[model samples]
Target: MDISDCKLLKVTMDFSKLNEWRTLPCPKCEIQLDIVLACGQSFRWTQLHPGIWCGVFAKKLWLLKQNEDEVMYQVFGGKTTDSTAELIDYLQLDVNLNDLYKKWAKDDSIFSKMVDNKFHGIRVLRQDPVENLFSFICSSNNNIERISSMVEELCVHYGEQIETFGEKTFYAFPTVKALASVGVEAKLRELKFGYRAGYISRTAEYINSQEEGEKWLYNLRMEPYDIAREKLQKLTGVGAKVADCVCLMSLDKPGAIPVDTHVQQIACRDYLPSLKDKKSLTPKCYDEIATHFRNLWGEYAGWAQAVLFAAELQRPKVKNLVCLPQGRKSTKMEEIAKVSEPKTKIKRKKIK
Candidate 1:
């Protein structure tokens, strides 16, 4: 209930896309990440029958349509706190918005010029660096649903608690010490985390035990983001895409472009011979393609990729479009997907 350290602002922005944007279901489980995280506002966890400290005022980059202006609302931790203001003033989410508009204008890059001269919106919102690293590690070959599940499992079993969001409780993201406290291999598998368990535990151990963990990552920042990616490639279970995801989302490395399976497919479909064959197109071929994309989009490469990734993940399902009255729905209706999906039923909806 204490937010004395939080800042406040009243910038002109739109959130008309709040509901539509929140609809992006978790790719792995097909539930909504927003709903799982409680619309990015309530990251709660209940312990010992009482709600204790375990919530983070998180922010998400949203495509908000305000009147004629289609812009991003940095919704979450804001300049001020009844928890209402946009994150623009806080995270200082930045990139050349004008340049991004051009690139995202069409199937073409957001940088392309529009005939009407009205710019399409574009920008990047920074996230907590440490969380971003661990999150992407859960993301390898796995769907967003499974990734979110593993992350929640990681926290519930290890993270500390936050208390601001009432008895609505949540575990803190596990720290190096916290993560090292238990055997991740068994816990992760028991939670159905798939193969990522090994990577998660090994990475956590290295991060905690090494005297030079931060220094190692910090020094990578000095190199070009691609080179830094090469360094991370040496870690366990970190493939080209996973390393790039960490680079772009966590490190704020603009040149880092994560070529997820979706991106790989898009690349092959949109451009010529995008896929790398064994002899001619190796992993290096993929890197070169990512580099081409990074160079083409310039600085907002990471941000641009996020918007695209979100769009791709949202399979445009219209199977059940339940429009609730604008007034708040009771909290009980939310999908606690991350924590309970392993035991949850699978519901499929059609995209009308």
Candidate 2:
């Protein structure tokens, strides 16, 4: 389970031979695969190349790419059934994103000014509740890169291997049973999970003790947002913010806004000048901020929060193009050139 040995295996594999690539009518205004995949919503997706992303979701390995109007995808491993409906549900393409953008712009003046093509198509991902719950548990006071590494370690150690491409392998997220087994905390500590080790182990055991086990977590989707949030907080290591994240990302509650220090700053600086003097976010302050955004952005407030978060983090810029000129044909060299190239200024020798 030494994950460092897992090199980039897909770089050499032929993508076309696994399955026929299909297209879904996904415009950039509706879905920007580059931004949506890399944003903090999910940690599994890797941008194998510019405008092309690879990830495992919905129990399948996916190689996905997009243009201005459509998304192209190829599938490998898992069930061989049609994934069109699954993809739509995961992406939530049924929702009118363009309409939401217009509504958000109309409601907040700062948002109106900040809304640009770069941040467009940013949305909350509908992820697996079990996976989402554990992932965010690993997120407390941690950076995204470390969180991703921890998640992968969880998979590599306990989850079933999904597929093997030459020397490297891909794994699905571990099941509650796998994580709840004996000595999970000790094993996790050995892997350097720190104090969060106890949290994850106890939480898994708690879930497994439920009448229906993991199904109970899925059933949270049907409960009221308040009820779901309250229930999730009952587990070990889960607090208000973690519960809110589960509610927003997976439990079908678009209005559940998870407020962290970053969000607190955004609210005080851009929208609520009155709250600026408060030194820290108390329970009353947290509710005040969440309630304000819920009222301001309406039901899809979580989605709106994602856009602001991306801006606050100052996510790196990526090249976006609909298509090449009518007569200009794309070449392999051009594609390779698009990858980030290091820029350095050299002091040229003065011609004496």
Candidate 3:
């Protein structure tokens, strides 16, 4: 299927005339809503039921379910004449991902094997820039579960309430002004945000103070990848990895490859076998890895990286454990036992 040959049209319709449960065909590849939502990209969506996930987007609350041939969805709180169009755009449904898979596979055989029959429906989301920026900033040195918790806390503390659905309530992602008006750092610290509290607070203040405000962030989509990344790096907590994430996910930079630990490991183990000897990835090595993938996957390198990253997450690994043999303990065993202990009591420094 040549995606370029197909005329991709946005879905537009009057939602009021339609039934509460409507289905949208997904013939190219099955829309794996679970994988797409859980793949460490956007972090706000929650599973309300089996195959049913709910989230707030564009200041509207929505519930969606996926089946074999179609996606079923409905808008809950807000009225939009073209909810289907919005959903199509949000999912990037018009873009043929199977075509992309074929292209990526043709370029790298290793990628072909790595992505073979796994994560077929994983797509990089076109997330809102402001929301994505703050979200990734909270992602530094954080796991997905903790990051989701922080984002939810931010919305609950500063965002506007949309409506209540059963026992769960949805809140709009807070505006820069709204986030800045509250003592953001103090409030976030109180919510156990740790050092990231300062980053989110300062970045929100910086964005709010800009003459163009959110528009300034959105305009990066028009800039070249490097220039946009440089501008994003200027934000308080944003580094190269975080900047690349926002660029790829929000700023319309499809070629931007975020080289994190998982990505670096993938490059060393699969793409660049010569790099296997290197224990730590220096800045030079990081750029080499990023450049390698960008050149290999072409314009949609970020999307390729995303699929590989999700694959890496799904791969199983053996955990090292220490066992004692009937009260006989050696120094080696003692050291391994210490290593096996989980750091659950670690304390975080408070922001002043």
Candidate 4:
């Protein structure tokens, strides 16, 4: 349909140190696209088809300016435009440059460099809570490419489409009203949500009928960030790590730190030497391990943890987080493609 018929709302949020955070009219739906946890990677939404218009394709974001409260932003194309001038323009799309970065640069040191490296062209694009929850539920023991495929398949199968720019279709990350209102079992199978589909369905059914806010796990961004975190861990499929992720990205508890296996490995190796010799660890230990950094990195702790993990994974020594290769090490991308390879080969041979 016609997007011109709708009014758009834009809100800018500067997530302390992680990166730029903003939401604007989806070029398609004219609705707010809630992309959060501002960062450089957006494989969550764009992996299926490069440049594909689905009303949403998480783009790279940059900070135009940062005042005492907010940071203006723009999203750059990626590894290609890694310069200041280009990065600045990408963020100043509709704002003025008031030397905000320069002021922050006055205290130039390691932190400034960290901000320069991580903050420039970074954005936490908001996402639909239900979608983020489901997407993340599928995250445990999962890879990026697989996560992308699973989420996309869910949209294609169960989500409604928003007709936008040339073939642009967007799905509203199926709600309880949507999933419970429909055939969840078959939909889960179709999307390949895997074993957790039942748990996901259970969670949705429980929450959909309640007054549970989008911030239910986040406690409406009102409670002390820690308490909000406590509430998140109460959900199934959500351990200390998953809950922290939802809190950081959805609940605005920017301080929330998630410790998945990768982060756990890093913690024991670098920070938590005391926990090293001990065989059995508890959630309290994970919290203790993550909390130290949360304080160290300030509000950017979650982002820092993610960066540390991403950097470590690139080291070539780390194994897969969710799925490993049959005989060799595999990046998340390799693993996802591998999942469908045998089927693809049989189809190709049959056609030949």
Give the top-scoring candidate (TM-score): 2
Distance from true location, Cα of 248 in model 1, Å? 0.6
C-alpha RMSD of candidate 2 = 11.4
Evaluate residue 270 in candidate 3 and report its C-alpha lDDT on the 0 to 100 scale: 86
Candidates sorted on lDDT, descending: 2, 3, 1, 4
Q: So what's the TM-score on candidate 4?
A: 0.57
Per residue, candidate 4 scores C-alpha lDDT tens digits across 1-31 of 0001111111221122222233221121111
* Tens-digit per-residue lDDT, 195-248, candidate 2: 989999999999999999989999999999999999999999999899999999
Clashes of 3: 0
The parts of candidate 1 lying over 4 Å away from their true place are 1-86, 89-92, 103-123, 164-167, 213-223, 274-281, 310-352
Over 4 Å off in model 2, which ranges?
1-18, 316-352
lDDT by residue (tens digit), candidate 3, 85-164: 77777777766677788888888998788875657887888888888999888888776667877888888888888866
lDDT of each: 0.45, 0.78, 0.73, 0.45
Candidate 2: residue 273 Cα off by (Å):
1.1
RMSD of 1: 13.5
